[model samples]
Target: MLRTLLKSVSELSTKIDKLIFLCQRSAMGVIDRRTEEMDSDAIHFPLRTHEELRSLEAALDNKKYRDHFVARLRNLMCDDTRKSAKACLQYILSPELANIYTLHGTRSKFGISKYKFYSTVQSALCSHFRSASCPEKEILHAMATASQAFLHDARNKVHKRGWRSKERLASQALSDVTNIINDTSTST
Candidate 1:
């Protein structure tokens, strides 16, 4: 009787573990779907003009321009200038910055001209860093430099075929599992 009780408990535990695993997987799928939707919205944001597109492309392609801007940022000595540069660099390197780069290529569809983009970025940096001594132009230049470096890096990732995003990997896994299940069902 004890042996039978132990066997039943073992089976019950295995079933509970399987149930918990499935629940966790389902919750993760919901989270992944929501994240993918948000990313899609960002990627599809519209561009304001052809000039803006061209400007973004030029920045992404010009390695010399990007390097020069980065060099200027690195050379900044003023306390205010350093604070502004730090803010600009942090923004550029953030995952949220992906909204500025369209998935189509190095082109951006941020619905703003290059000048406006720089202005907006500078405003954002100033608000975050409160650098009263940094010249506005210097801050703008730092933002532009950081943006160019980010775009250049993104372009290189495309060229090198960077790792697939989590959403893509999850989708592929689901497809493979479906195929396997269908094959097994048909074979049996």
Candidate 2:
């Protein structure tokens, strides 16, 4: 009788283990689904320049991510030894990247050929300021200015325009965005 009781207990334990496994799997599924919903939320209701500008403004106003991005830009921009911001845009003219676009099926773009050379520290810093027409380097470069004009334009939306080079700005915009933007990373 004792042996019979032990066997029954063993069976019960096995069933309990299976139940625990199922519960854990179900919980994981719920977590994954929740994560997907949050990510999709960002997409279905994407953060436009106006919104990001607002969010960034709030963050800067509150002295949040501003500290990180501000310090990074200060370091990157002060290094004149590095290539100019416009020079970085040369990738926009590349045959491989230019001919192909990964923008949403419909959106305006920066006319790459139309970009003008930036003159002073202020202009270069503000070239892509509020327009959000320029590349990441330009964005980071703009932060380097710490110039009132840069912040003023961004705050006032002085150069509001379609976000061009979606391929560079939005990750979902392009399949090869990493290579497209960091194409110059290998050189330096």
Candidate 3:
């Protein structure tokens, strides 16, 4: 019991530390696109697909990808002269889009809540990128599909079989109404 509490505290502390570092980098001018070179060694591999994400996750599981992704994200986030990081985050986190190159920092790494929904999304992205050459639209489609699936699963649990039967009955009734309207129109 004590161990779990300790682990939670440690994780929370680490997250806070990372957030602090991000803020510090933002304050410093290290993130300015104008002042920074695009081809700098401080950057890490871009994460645009699930495969890349998986690689990052693999690297993360081995404790190798954290520093690199964090540095890159921090640098990008710190870019005060441009909207690169903000735009990237917005696109990456968008439900309608998959910001493949930036969303999942590394493979095994989970976000704040360690939610499986996001992990499943990362895996789907990895699979999509691995199978296709041009994946921009594909990734977005996958995200939308995955999101719907996740939401459906969550909603399904709350919905009883009785409710589904009721829904079917309601649909049949609506269809009958439509049929009657069509018959009336045809006769007129």
**Which predicted model would earn the best lDDT?**
1
Lowest summed lDDT window (length 10), candidate 1: 36-45
Q: Candidate 2: what lDDT? A: 0.36
Clashes of each: 0, 0, 13
lDDT, candidate 1, 120-162, per-residue tens: 4456555544555666666666656655555555446544566
Of the candidates numbered 1 and 3, which has the greater TM-score value? 1
Colliding residue pairs in candidate 2: none
Q: Cα lDDT of model 3 overall?
A: 0.43
Show the lowest summed lDDT stretch of 10 residues, model 2.
Answer: 37-46
Ranking by TM-score: 1, 3, 2
Question: What are the models' TM-scores?
Answer: 0.35, 0.22, 0.24
Candidate 2 runs further than 4 Å off = 1-48, 81-188
lDDT scores of the candidates, listed in order: 0.48, 0.36, 0.43
Runs of candidate 1 with Cα error greater than 4 angstroms are 1-118, 124-134, 155-161, 182-188
What C-alpha lDDT, on a 0 to 100 scale, does residue 151 get in candidate 2? 28
Angstrom error at residue 115, model 2: 22
Q: Measured by C-alpha RMSD in angstroms, how accurate is candidate 1? A: 18.9
